[model samples]
Target: MLVYDVATRTVAAANKAAMRLYGYSREEFAGLPITELRPPEDRAPFLEDFDVLVSRDGPASGTRGVRRHIRKDGTRFSVEPTYHMMRYAGRRGCFVVVIDVTEKEHSRELLSRQADVDSLTSLPNRKRFNERLEQAIDDARRNNTGVALVFMDVDHFKDVNDSLGHGVGDRLLQEIASRLSSCVGPSDTVARYGGDEFVMVVLENGANSDSVAGGACQCDRQSEVIAHVMRVFAAPIAIDDTEFHVETSIGVACFPADGDDAETLLRRADLAMFRAKSNGRNGLQRFTPALGKQADERLSLSRRMRVALSNGEFRLEYQPQVDLQTHRVTGVEALLRWHDAEHGSVSPATFIPIAEENGLIAPIGEWVVQQACFQAQAWQESLPGLRMSVNLSPRQLARGDIVCVIQRALARAQLAPQLLEVEITEGALLNAGSAELLEALRAMNVDIAIDDFGTGYSSLSRLRRFRAERLKLDMSFVRGIGVHREDEVIARAILSLGHALGFSVVAEGVETDLQLAFLRRHGCDVVQGYRFARPMPAVDAYTFIHRFNAGSLVPS
Candidate 1:
């Protein structure tokens, strides 16, 4: 090992091991300066520490322990740089020993990088995004600059998962990540924020920083980025020889404009993205106060709906369906009504679709069935021949559990299957072939009528396949029976087709005398309209049926 001389400031001598440790010839070690072992920038600090060591002890004492150093090749490795407070070449000096730690330091650096990088996309993850955002925020505050944070989400991404499968969904996400990376500059960053959402941060530059001192200016840039992103995402991305199209809706919230912090800005951007999807897909939106309020309202309404069934906030109204020939109350169709505690009497049109989408329709449907059957049993006890018809939504049909629900309701109500009619629209039956629940319902010998028959797409062949007992013509076909030739022809044809198939035909929404006369002429088995009775509660329906049977009814 070489000994370092403090008084003379020279390398006195070197052993073979010391010369090899520093990748130097013995002569080279003797000629080289001690400062050569340290980085140029660290040499000043090293020298200051050296002066303190020399004052406390001789150079040999300072070099007694290990010291870190770099080689002449500019490669760094830690060294003991040990020294002994003894005479070297008749001068007080120190002996140095070196040990290499290059591999260990390199490994630590690699692990640090791996922690920040995403394994799949190879882009940064949300963790790295947060850390980078903190630095960016500090920089923005110091330089008085602007930063934009964009939140982008894929539109109809669930469809990809549903139709193509999750494998394709994963591939699509990867391709999208690549395309997004291409759109942004090197100074900006794009991160996969989780799920199908991504976050991008772009800092303001040059003169733009002064004009837009807040991060929200990037909200305007959302349209530009979205246009490029959409064009890139719009074209099909292929997976396993199949090409799939993808689109996105972006929400933009600028730093300082939306919020200076990460959480607030991210939340706002998420809200704006949801707004874009709600307004219509394939678009971008900036966060707004009104949109936030609307989201809060919808969330409140959805929460209330979830508890509605449990709280017994629902009611059923029955509208009579009369037989024209017998002039008797053949059946009453059950309609659902909701009386919201906050927003009273919500319309079926408004909440029904929401219920279906949220998967709440199945339970709500069961309640309707049980209530309708119980009411029909009550009416049958009073009138002896009345039937109750309950409408089935498409969502309920898709689940294929309607038969089991009906069986349970009938058992609870102690009602005969014939007196309980389930009305399913044509749309519900369109995909009923593979539905075991529907097939089970057909096997039960319960009356299944195709309600609003002509309102949906149906074929003569498909109509024959359904286990239906009656066909109720939609109001549209019955609206202008005598006035419009097409309407008359369609109504008559539907009635004829129903009769030919051994099914009873009923004309719904028959409000006029002419429409009733026209249907009676066309051999319609039944007619239901405001002319007979509007949908009313059970008490009124009982009175209306009694009055009609007594021939004491007045024309409205």
Candidate 2:
């Protein structure tokens, strides 16, 4: 307990409790003002203004601000401070009562962190990011300068979450956020914003409106901030000392010229981001009027896609994955196709993302799995022990229902689980949930293969964790087999690495003898594409396999 004179601004009397809490003896504390108990930075403010606003109080209410007291050893702790007018034995003064609430302070700190920071990446959360953006815009407008907002999110994030364990997936998000912060200037703001989504703001004060507008020259600042960031993100994000492919679609918008307010600018920038991902992910697009129209068109397409799902307009196609060594058909991957009554033939590349976006991917994917299993069973008599490879969408995998669907499909077709291989992208194998699902599939004797292995950003750590049975080399690398040494190196590396890891390598898109010889020499176990035969109907595929087995049909 301490009695402080408001008139003289001095501590008049103190007890042993006060001395012990403060590490100050009676002589040391005598004649000192109450402000002396505060840290150096807060002392001046307490004397100049805080005293006027905070002192002369009853029980400390929410209206009274929280303050801290510093010990002689320089340790500061939060205290609940309240004072009331009282007369002491000798003089009249304020009787101050302080209750140290360090534990409550710790709880407050945790709550504050949870509100402002992303739990997974420890970066600024969406609310904090928005606050920073709003502040930047205000400052930019006052100074007649520009503030650029960069909206970015990971590409194929669903694949990572669905394939890898959630723990690794979270670690991947942290890795990306850490890399982004490294490239970001101290004055700029970088935030996680949300799952796999990030937002950044860079302030350029004293800029003219022309420079603030989204144009070719907006990227010409002396610091070249955007270019530097792009260069940094170009490298694959490394996690646990292994590479996980990282790519993002970035959208940029400027203040004043692009949009005066936060909502307007964010909306425009987000539209541009959608354009980048739709055109091709892993790129940047600045806000423009045209892109907004395209965005509207996409929204229309998404609505149409929801309708298409109800009408049962989706179909499946099978592409055979052939064994190179034995010259036998190992499996066929089910592919989705859709023909819109109004738009004619719509490519999977176009409608597939829309389906995923509109929440139709799960049901559509379940249908494909069931249909493909039925067809595989129908052809099993002619092609005994033939396998069926079905592609699992990221959404289906994220929901972790693909395994149950696979079990039901096998039951419906009376197909052996060994003859059912589910093809998944390397991106899908990075999260804990995916690992659990894959482990379940493995336990059921279902074959698991990582589809398009080399093309996507991959992690070696995940490969050994997957218990995968096959590695399907991407067509992009296979097409360049004889033409590019770099492609040859990558292909050979994949085959060698895969074989070393005990995974069968299925080289895709083998259209020429040169490609075939290259794959065979490199020890690829399987080849699939036009070089052997195109994806055929179930009946033709069975007959083709029978003839090939009888030595009547041969590779061209």
lDDT score for candidate 2 against the true structure: 0.80
Badly placed stretches (over 4 Å) of model 2 are 1-250, 254-264, 273-284, 456-461, 537-543, 546-556
Q: What is the lDDT of residue 510 in candidate 1?
A: 90
CA-lDDT, candidates in order: 0.78, 0.80
Error of 1 at 185 (Å): 3.7
lDDT of 1 by residue, 460-487 (tens): 8877777578998999989968779998
> Residue 327 CA error for candidate 1 (Å)?
5.3
- The TM-score that candidate 2 achieves is 0.60
TM-scores of the models, in the order given: 0.67, 0.60
> What are the per-residue Cα lDDT tens digits for candidate 2 across 319-380?
67777777777777777877777777788887877778878888888888888889888888
Instruction: Indicate which candidate wins on TM-score.
Output: 1
